[model samples]
Each structure stands twice: as C-alpha cells, then as structure tokens.
Target: MQYINFLPCEWNNDHGFTQEIFAIAIKNNIGIGNPDTVPYRKSQMKNSYQFLHKYKADINTITIAVQEPDYTYTNPKTSKKFTQAELYDFDKNYIGANIIFWNIQQPQFDSVLKFFANN
Candidate 1:
C-alpha cells in the first residue's frame, strides 16, 4: 500500500476519527511515518508513534526528518531553484529518515544518542 496522511482537514481537537483511519491504513500495510508535518504537531507525532508501535509497522521502512539544511535546493530535473522557505516546507512535507537513521541535529538528537550510549 502507499502512504497516507492522517492529519484531518478540521483540527477541531477530535482525533478519534483520525486514529481509526490510521488503524485501517496500517492493517492494509501502508507505510507509516513518512512526510512528517510542519511544526511537527505534538498530537500527530504522538499518534504516529503510538500506531507505529501498536501495529508493529515495518521498522525498516519508517522515515523521519533528520536535518534542517540552511540552503536552497535546485531541482535537477527542471532546473528550478527552491527558496529556503520552500525547502523547509518540502522537508516537513516529504523528506524523512528511519528512526534508526534519522539525521537530526543537536539537543533533541543529542539526548537520544546520549541515552543510547549510556544504556
């Protein structure tokens, strides 16, 4: 199955419907955790991990954003250059890394690394 976005059109603070949809998608083998959203909303993040653990989503296929490159990207195919804001938007909407392979920067990722090294 392909990827699915569980973020609802209406963010009315109700997540029950979205949760059900995610369950269905997981049951059908849809890839989870790709294309994380902007601002990385806390609710979405929580739900994604919960479902990922609950459904035992394939660990190898899962992805998460690792870094915030401070540069513009030129599309090789069309030769169209993307502004930094556009790049950030794309990263938030389309790019990701596996939990194990996420190329994140300091602080948050530092904590994760430290925890693993200590334990």
Candidate 2:
C-alpha cells in the first residue's frame, strides 16, 4: 500500500508533526510512533499504554519535502532511484537504513493526501 508519511520530522516539536500525524492516525484508526514520539510520549503515557520494540521491522520511513520521478524517489543514502513499488519493498526489507523521497510535486502530494484521507 502506498502511504503519505504525515510523520515526516521527529523529536522537534516545532516540526509539522505530532498533531498532524496523530490526526491522521485518528482518522485512519491506525497507530504510529517514531524515534522522537516514542521516547517523549512513552514516559508520559506509560501508565495507560505499553511500549513495544517492534521497529526493527521498519526503520526510518520519512518522506522528504521533494519527490523524484513519477512521484517516486532516489534513495538519498544510496543515490539510487527506485520506483514506488521498489521503494516500499526496500522499506519493508531494509532494516538498518532510511529512505527519503525527493522533489515531490503538488500532484504527488495530492495523490498522497487522497490516499491517506480517503482510504
């Protein structure tokens, strides 16, 4: 499944996250966490929630402000251009790295919002 990463930045509260990502999860009825949110919220929510170490299955999956070709991207770390399918596959399989989408145009952004909002 194609997903628009609403949780783009981690740790910094000034980043356009926390609220947006939580809103998305609330809307989608899905749960999410990250390097930043995990530590920050875990302590506060410990009494009511349980924290799990299931992130090895998915490392850092953040979308850059830009998108590459066909709304796809080139792996900044590898300088390799991977198709959407390939990228998602890489995300699932690669356990020790990060994937960033570069040069994203508005259309791609729209498609992402549509997928997230309507799906």
Q: Using TM-score, give the best candidate's number.
A: 1
Q: What does candidate 2's lDDT look like per residue over 32-94, in tens digits? A: 432211111333223111211223233233322223343343444556654444434433333
Model 1: worst 10 consecutive residues (lDDT sum): 92-101
| Per-residue error (Å), model 1, residue 68 | 0.6
Q: Name the regions of candidate 2 deviating beyond 4 angstroms.
A: 1-12, 15-17, 20-72, 90-119
Pairs with steric clashes in candidate 2: 66-102, 66-103, 66-104, 67-102, 67-103, 67-104
The digit string of per-residue lDDT tens for model 1 on 2-65 reads 3444555534226575567666665665555544433333454454544544454333354444
Per-candidate TM-scores read: 0.37, 0.24
Backbone clash pairs for candidate 1 read: 63-97, 64-97, 66-103
